[model samples]
Target: MFKPLIKKIAIRIKFLRSLSVNHWRYLFRNLNLKELNIILVSLGLAATAGLFLSVYDYWALRTPAPAEGGSYAEGLVGEPRYLNPVLASANEVDRDLTTLIFSGLVKHDESGRIIPDLAERYEIKGNGKTYEFTLRSGLSWPDKTPFTPDDVIFTINLIKDPKFQSPLRNSWQGVKVEKIDNRRLAMKLPVEYEPFLENAAVGILPQHLWANIQPQNFLLTQLNLKPVGLGQYQLAKITKNASGSVRSMEFSPNPRYHEKANIARLTLRFYDNQESVLGAYKRREIDGFSLSSPLEKEELARSRSVKFYDIKLPRYFAVFFNQTASESLKETEVRRALAHAVDRASIIEEILKGEGEIQNGPFSFNLLDIGDPETIYEFNVEKARNILEKDDWKIGDDGLRQKKIKGKNIKLEFVLTTTDWPELTRVAASVQKNWEDIGVKVNLDIVPVNAVQTQTIRPRQYEALLFGEVLGLNPDPFSFWHSTQRKDPGLNLALYNNKKADGLLESARQESNLPTRIKEYGQFQEILMKEIPAVFLYSPNYTYAVSKKVKGVAVTAINTPSQRFENINKWHIATKRVKK
Candidate 1:
C-alpha cells in the first residue's frame, strides 16, 4: 500500500512537469489545495484502515485548517501594470516589487524623516530651489554596471520628456537635472522649493541598461517587463502563459543590494480579478499580500498560527465633484448642500462595514492631523434642503429637484470615474442614493484602475471622481488641492481654480520654517473645509496579516502610501531554518 501511494505521488510529480503553462498555473495555484487534499485523504485512509468506523463524525474535518503560509497565498492585487518605478504610480503591488528592484537617493524613516539611501548627504541652495546631492560610494547595479551621477541625470531627463508620460513629472517637473561629478548630481527647482528634499523619495533608475530603450515608448518596451534592477532582487525566470505571453514575476535575491535581502525570493502570481485573488489566498497559494474583504480580516485575525495586523493608516477615498459643472454644483449653497446631504456616518457604518473613521477635515489625516470630527459637518437632511432652496432649486411635482433654468426643469446628473475598489463602488452607490434623496442625479462608471488615472482624473475629464489619495505628512497642498495644480503636471483632480485656495496653498508651500509651514497648512485646511470643494470622506485603515514566525513588525502613520514591506529588510522569520 505504501509503495502504491509513493508511486501515485511520483506520477503526479512527473505529470506536473509535462503540463502546459495554464495547468502549471493551476497546480502552483492549488499547491496548498493539492497538498492539503492529499494529507486529508491519507488521514481518511488511516481511519478506514482501522476496522471500527463508529459513527464517522466529521468533527476534526470541520475544524479550522492550520493558519500557515496558505493564508498569505491570496489577495496580492495581481501583477503590476507598470514594473518600472519611473513609470509607476502609487500602486501597492508595483511599489512592493519596485522596492525590491530599485532604490532612491533618500528613504523615509519610521518618523517620516528623510534618511540616506543611494545618497549619503545632500546640500540645498539658499533659495531652496537648487539641490546638490552626493552619493554613497561602492554601489553597483545587478548587471555589475557602476552606479553614477549620469544615471540620475538621464532619469531626470527621461521624466521631463513629454513622450514618456513619466508619472514623476508631477513631482519632478520643476527641477532641472545635471550631473555635478561622477559621484554627485545637482537639481534646479522652478520655485521657492517645497517637497524637494523629500522628492528624493523617488526611485532612481539604472540608466546603463534602460537608456537604450526609446523614451517615446518606454512603458511598452520589451525591456520594461524584464529590466535589470539596482535594488534587492534580481530577475530569476521570465515565465510565459500557454500563448507565450508574459505572466508571472519571479525574482531571486540581488547579490548587489547595499543591504542583505531578507527574503530569498519573491514571486507574484497573476490573477484576473479580486475574487480569484482572494481564492488563492484562502487556499494558501501565495505569500505576503494585502486584504480587501472584512470577512478575510476577521478569519485571519483569529488564526493564532499566523500573525495578523490591522494598523490604522492615513489613506482616504474621497469624492471630488466638478464644481464648474452646469452652474448646478457651482452655487456655494448647492455644493455645500450636496456635501451636507450625504450621511457619511451611516454610509461608513453600513456600507464600509465599520472599516474606517470619517475624515475630520479636508487636510487632516496623515498631513495635518487637526480637526474636530464632531464640529465638522454632519448629515442634516433639513439643512441640505434649505441650502438648495436658497439657490432656487425647488421640488417639482415629481418630488425630484428641478430648476427654472432658462425656463426649464433641469435635473442634475454627473458621471463618476473610479478604479474597481469594491468598497468605493458600494459607497458610490450609497452616495448616489443619498444624493437622489436630495434630488440630484449621479451616474457611476467603474473604469480600469490605470484608465481612471490616465484618462479621467489626470485629464480632469469627469463631472465627479472617486479615488484614494494620501497627502504626505509634511503637507503639500500645492500639489493636491491648490489652484496652480490645474495646470499640466499638477494633481488638481477637481480642476479647481480658486484665488484664495491658491494663495493659501502657495503660502503653505513657500514657508520653509516648520511652525510657519504648519500654521499656513492649518489655514489652508480651514479654508478647504469651509469651501467643501471635495466631499470629506473616511480615511481607511491598512490591514496586514503576517505569520507569527515573522518578527519585527511595526507601522508608521504613512503606512498606506508606502508598503509595510518597505522596511522589510529589518524583518526576519524566527522559525527560519539554518541551511546546510
Candidate 2:
C-alpha cells in the first residue's frame, strides 16, 4: 500500500513537470520577435494603465474624517490673572482660559444666535421678563461633581453681590435668578428685556467648591488659578518659568464635557504684548494668535502658513451728531449732506486696510440685515450738494458754506471730537477733508479716550462725537437710541427723540419673537435713516491669524473677544480618512 501511494505521487509530479515544459515549448515555437515585442509592449501598457488607475482610485476613495487627537498651541498677549469666570472679564488671558474651561447656561453661536450650552432647553415667559432654563442631564463639573441649579444660582448671586465686584455685575443688576429644582433654574427680570438672555451666557461656577469661599476672598482664592467647571476643557497642567509667571497653560478635554472637544490638548502661552506674540508665531512656537494691532496684519500676510480670518465684530464706528449743540447740524438737509459727503469706502480702504464693512445703520449684524432697502444711504456728492443748496445754503467767498435764515448767518462748520486712536484720528482727518471739499468748514478735536469719555461724552459737550459702540451680541437699540437715554448718562449722542422711533425700539426690546423683533428693528432703522441722527460709517473687522494646521474655526458677529471660543470644541488639529 505504501509503494502504490509513492508511485501515484511520483506519477502526478512527473505529469505536472511535462505539462509545464510542453506549454513553454509550444509558446516559444508559435511566437516570433515581432509578435513577442507587441506582446511585451501590450503588457507594459497594461501595467502602466493599472498603476495609474490604482493611484487615482486610492485618492478618490478617501474622505476626510475628524481624528480624535492632537495638540494646539496659541499665543496670548497677557498672562492669566484670574481664571475664575466671575473675574475673567478684567483680563483677556483669563477670559481665554475661562471660555474653554467653563460652560455657560446659554451661549452665542457662530451666527450670534443665543443657544443652550449647559441648558438642555429654555423658555421665555411672562411677557419676556422671565427665562426658565433646564440643565442637561448627566452634566458634571471637571471634578465630577454634579452640575445643578444650585451652581447657576451661586454664580448669579455672586455676580449680584456688590462686594464681589465682578465686571459683569452691570449686566445682571436688575435680574433675579431662582432655583426651580435640582436640574432647573429661572431668571426673572424686573423689566421686559429680550437681551437679558445674553447675560445668562456667562459661565456658571460649581456651587459645591465655591460655596465655602467668602465674597472677599473670591479673587484671592487659589481656585482662580486652577478653576473647575463644566467646560469643554479642564486644567491638566500649568507650567511656570523661574519668575513665577505662567509660561504656558495646558488643557485636556474634559471627560464630563457635554460636547466632545476634537482637540485632545490646547496649550496657551502668555506673552507680554502683541510683539512677543507675533515673535513666538514667527518662531513656529505657536500656531495661532488673535489680531490686536494693525501692524500685525502685514506680518500675518508675510507668513504663508498662516491664514487671516476677517471676523466682523458687533461694534460700529460712526459720527454721532449732537444736533442739540450744533446749530448747523440741526438742519435736516445739512445732516443729510454731511452723511453723503464722506466716502465710507475710502475710510475702510485707507484707515482699516480694507478690513471693515460699510455700516448702513445702528444694527450692524450682517445676519440680521433688518434695515429697509429704501433706508440705504449712498455717497453721492451731487445729491448731497443738491440737498444743501435747496435749503438756501450758498458758498461764501471764504470757500465755506454759509446760510442766512431767520436774520442770522450760520456757517456749515462744527468741531468733530474723537479719541486719539490711530484709526479714529485718520478717520476724522478723512472726514474733515471730505467736508472741506464740499465747501463746509470742519475742525477735528482728538483727545485721549478717557478724557473724551469723561469730559466730552458724559457731559454731551462735543458738537459731533466720532466714536464706536458695541451693540452686544443682540443689537439692543434701547440703550443707544431710546429717547429716555438722551440725557448726560444716555448713549443717545444725537439727542434724537421721535415718538414712533421710541415705540418701535421699546416693542422690539419686548418682542421675544425673532421675526417680529426684526421687523420692528427694520422700521426703527427706516426712522433713523430718515432722521439722519447719526452718520453710520463702518464696522471694523476682528482679524485673526490662525495656522493652517487648525481647522473648523468659524467666527461670526462676536460681541466680545472671548466669544470667539464659543465653537472651540469643533476645532481640530489632526484628521483621518474614512468612508463618506
lDDT of 2 by residue, 452-526 (tens): 767888789889889988787677878789898898556788888999999999888878788998989888888
**Candidate 2 weakest ten by summed lDDT:** 1-10
lDDT of each: 0.68, 0.83
| Model 2 misplaced regions, further than 4 Å | 1-64, 77-82, 87-94, 125-130, 142-144, 189-196, 212-226, 235-248, 270-276, 292-299, 323-331, 382-413, 447-461, 472-474, 486-495, 576-580
Per-prediction TM-score, please?
0.79, 0.77
Tens-digit lDDT track for model 1 on 232-266?
Answer: 56767766788765566777666676777555556
* Model 1 misplaced regions, further than 4 Å: 1-75, 90-92, 125-127, 220-222, 367-375, 412-420, 441-450, 487-489, 559-562, 574-580
Query: How does candidate 2 fare on TM-score?
Result: 0.77
Q: Which model scores highest in lDDT?
A: 2
RMSD of each: 14.8, 8.9
